[model samples]
Target: MKFYRLTFLASVFLTAVMLLLVYVFDSAKHSFSETNKQFFQTLIISALILSVINYLVVDFLFNFYGKRQIQKISTILPEEIRDEESNLNFKQLSQKFTDLNLKNTTEIDMMKEMEFYRKEYIGNISHEMKTPLFTIQGYVDTLLEGGVENLAIRDKYLERIDKSVERLLNIVKDLDMINQFESGEIILNKSRFDLNEMIREMIDVLDLEAQKKNTKIVLQTTSNLMFVNADQQKISQVLLNLISNAIYYSNRESATVTIKTKVENHKVLVEVEDNGMGIKAEMLPRIFERFYRIESSRNRSDGGSGLGLAIVKHILEAHGESIAVESVYLEGAKFSFSVAKAI
Candidate 1:
């Protein structure tokens, strides 16, 4: 409707201009000296013919250009929005272009963010591997340069080299485990187990390490047997990591790490809290990221491959659960997670 209206207006304007030129030429040639009626008839006939021709030309050109523009737009539009039965007018086309531009900008920003993380991950891996490799190389070199003759020196260097090799192996092993989890290669073998008993066992295992830090691990739970449905091995690893971290990061003279559990609805809520140097609030978001450390000075010497918390997070997530943490810097921190209660 709009197309025909525009062409009609344009044809009228062009025909009027052409008629004016014709009138001027006819007056110069005295062609109007015939009857006035005949003169008017000739003018009307000329106007009708000119108007028809102009309207046809304008309509053809408009359709040709409009189709070309629509074809270009169709190529860029998503399949969901493209319509062959209906013509997209100027307003709809403008809106689609705006939406496309915004989508492209968002995608570009995400790509840039992923690129940054990729670079950071590569650099962290290199640094971690380099430290252990260098330590092993230095100690081996010392042993080769006449240091092997002394029994004491050889023993000391060999021990240090062994520790470095172990650290390298730990990093590789943790990385592989995390990769398996992320790639869906590790399957959880869910079983019903006593959550309380597991926590007690973990405390018994880490008791000596806690004693070295003058930290006492205490389990506070409402029941002696809180059964949960989860992978027993992975949950044990989670408990170990959390408890170990609590013991390691405790700064008090005689710190205390507490494991608390309670039955809530159809789930078991387990928390590992500690009276340690808590993490900063700003660093909480990245706390579970692989190789991320709250304290820059902490290294593999502090007894972690830096993938413990990351593994804990992955384990819980695989069980259709999540972990949460709360802390006040220099005061204390608590890590909590939940599991399905066995029916």
Candidate 2:
């Protein structure tokens, strides 16, 4: 419509200019014949009009396509994205598009990571469960195949089956405990207790393992009793897990595992250090992840539910504390945590 209006006005102006020129330059002797004058003016006007119409058509097509492309872009957006009167500029639209693209990319990456972890988790669970299940099945089969008729064989098979069953029970219990901790179902029974004394008790409980490994367990501290304000039982569990890990992973023939405590500000920092095949720097960050074994083959032989470190971490976090690990590849590893000091 705009192009048509402009062309009509341009034609009128050109026609007026022609008439004015003819009137201004007319001569009496060579005055143009009316028919001849009309014919010549018609020829000039036809050429001029055709050129103008061609330029107008090109200009109109350019604008038409530009508007059509913009309209196509607008339709890709949802209706609720903008109000009818909100005239968004190209720059603003481009920024919004970039933001949406980034968000989509992040979500996609997260989903892929989750899928990978899911497969790893399932594989680990199956392997962990299957070992004990198979052992128990084998022992039962042995007893059924006339081994039960012999008193000696029957007793041995029964013992082996009992041990396998116990391992299964431990795994199940650890799983249940971790589930409860994650779901916020277990409430802490916080109280004031002697941290050092608790460590002593835990050492006594783990004495056989330490002796078996020929590792000497020692406690080093400024005082024998460093009291802390938290759940004693949970803290004991943390100590047991860390100390036991230290003992189990120790590579030295006569490894010395140390439990040390210090008072810093209003917190008691406890560290379990061992001169063992220390964890590699790369594995430190993931040491507390559930079922993440530093030495899968050796750890399996050592025997555990593989949820010990994870449980310890959750227990510390529940008490508003945090745990950290420091280690060199071959020197040794130290696991530490801080708890509020009893006033």
- Candidate 2, number of clashes: 0
Against the hidden true structure, what lDDT does model 2 obtain? 0.81
The superposed Cα distance between candidate 1 and the true structure at residue 29, in angstroms, equals 37
Instruction: Give the per-residue lDDT digits (tens) of candidate 2, residues 60-161.
Output: 655555545556677667554443324555555566667777888999999999999889988877888888888888888888888899999888888888
RMSD over all Cα atoms, model 1: 8.3
* lDDT of candidate model 1 versus the reference: 0.87
Misplaced by over 4 Å in model 1 are 1-65, 72-86
Local error of candidate 1 at residue 318 (angstroms): 0.9
TM-score between model 2 and native = 0.75
lDDT of each: 0.87, 0.81
Each candidate structure's TM-score, on Cα atoms with residue i matched to residue i, is 0.79, 0.75
Q: What is the C-alpha lDDT profile of model 1 across 222-335, one tens digit per residue?
A: 888999999999999999999999999997997999999999989999999998999998999999998999898876564668889999999999999999999999999999
Model 2 alpha-carbon drift over 4 Å, by segment: 1-87, 299-301
